[model samples]
Target: MNRKLWTLLIPVVILGLAALVYRQAPRFPQEGSAAVIFARDMRLHHAQAAELSLHLLERPVSKEVRLLAGDILVTQEAQIGQMGGWLDIWGLPFSGRQAPMAGMNRLSMGMATDAQVNSLDTLSPRQAEIQYLRLMIQHHRGGVLMAGQGLKSGVPQVEVLAQAIVNSQTAEISLMAGMLRQRGAAVAVGLPGGSMNGMPMKP
Candidate 1:
């Protein structure tokens, strides 16, 4: 009887241990990191800007402004599609349950606030230009952060993509900064870590 009991208990113990091990395994791939998160979140963020670009394109402006906004819209929309493609290929969602910007605390540049985005929408053409420039410059900074991190992390596609983001964004940053000074509204560009159009970074 004792021998029979031990035989039954052996299978039960093995099954119990197997269940525990399975439970402890991670749900997502172990490769999950800033590279993946940024791609997903930034795609959504860029989509929002792309929507605005469509609206602004019709509003009218100088050749330079129209060209700039047009380029931004087209480029970012393609980028969004590209990143979304990556997510699709990787079998990942475009966004997780976490807040877009907040979850990116571990990433480089994160998403802009909804309110900051709204302020961009509210400005008149002249005001909008400055706001767009400043906001986009800052937005690119966030992208740079993610891309730089991806480079350091040695994620293949992410590193290559990040370098591109840095190159493009650096140029935009200079352009916007120059434009701000030229307009004598450099002070209007909010300081980093300030209100961010009244929606402060989430804790």
Candidate 2:
């Protein structure tokens, strides 16, 4: 009788332990959660920024621009890691079901098309610097928009990362604008509704 009671109690204890472990596991984000969306999209976005920075490093440019490119390369690559790690932790795929920027405003702001990115390989050093600076400034603006969206996520970790992107990129935008001015290149105009320094761009 004692043996029979012990067998039944063993299974009950095992079941309770399983339930406790499941309860303690981290919760995965929903498919459409802001954290998931930001992680997926921003990983791809930061990858592009990393590529552009590498291109700039290979080109002949002023020390100022080189320093800026170095900074972007390090910062964005780390951010890519952060976002990718979040996706892995959440058990989500690297790419999402939705199209890129499907739900975001100012869709064209930061992204460089394949053609634009590929063309950088063929440009002269001076031309590459100018083109890269122009494209990056635009890209940074788009990033700020996405990061702003991330800040609205209720998840504390996601909001912290998003806010960091906003602060860093906003300052970089001003820095890039100054770089463009030093080189006598025109600042890349923002999208119709987008603005530098948070003011709306004029038509």
Candidate 3:
């Protein structure tokens, strides 16, 4: 074949392959519905809460703090079960395709990154407590944003769950804020429920 003809054929072949790939891709989130988005996102949120809670449970802490952490673990575990159950009811996997509303959006309730999780797992008891507090604050912030997004997105599928998430996370946010303050650690936020509380934003 002539060089020019070969070049033209390459483009056509590439386009055909691309089309096939696109067609084969899973129809994720089925329009990114609430049932889809919430199940997908909340799984991460709840997992982190459980992680931090489990860490605290394993650590020796002041009675007050330990008690609080214990409560968080139990409550969040129940909530996690509920969300996972929702996925089963919907005939969706516990984690589904990213919804359009949240596909590009990073969930604020997203728990620790792999590195952060690894660090938490490796730390000593005292350090674990501190890191748990910080990572959890970030995780909660992510949750708050998602819950708020769910509420704002008008997706009826996950609205009730999202609202429940907001209510629960808001309360936990306040609790963590107080925990940060009681530790004499100055956080950066002004609101109790806002994750910025008692910590400085990175410059």
TM-score of each: 0.67, 0.80, 0.65
Query: Best candidate per TM-score, number?
Result: 2
Q: So what's the TM-score on candidate 1?
A: 0.67
Q: Which candidate is the best by lDDT?
A: 2
Model 3 ranges with Cα > 4 A deviation: 1-31, 97-110, 121-124, 152-157, 190-203
Error of 3 at 99 (Å): 10
For model 3, residues 1-203, the per-residue Cα lDDT tens digits are: 89999988999999999999999975433435655676666666676788777866777766766787788788778877876776676567765454323443343334456677677567876666667776666666677666755675455656777887777766776776677777776544422333334463221
lDDT of 2 by residue, 8-114 (tens): 99999999999999999878777888888888778778888999888778877778788988999999899888888888888877877776566655345578777
CA deviation > 4 Å runs, candidate 1: 1-31, 97-99, 104-115, 120-122, 187-191, 194-203
Rank list by lDDT: 2, 3, 1
* lDDT comparison, 2 vs 3, better candidate: 2
- lDDT per residue for candidate 1 within 68-149, as digits (tens), equals 7789898988888887787777677776666555544422243456676676557687777776666666666665555555
lDDT of 1 at 129: 71
Off by over 4 Å in 2: 1-25, 99-107, 192-203
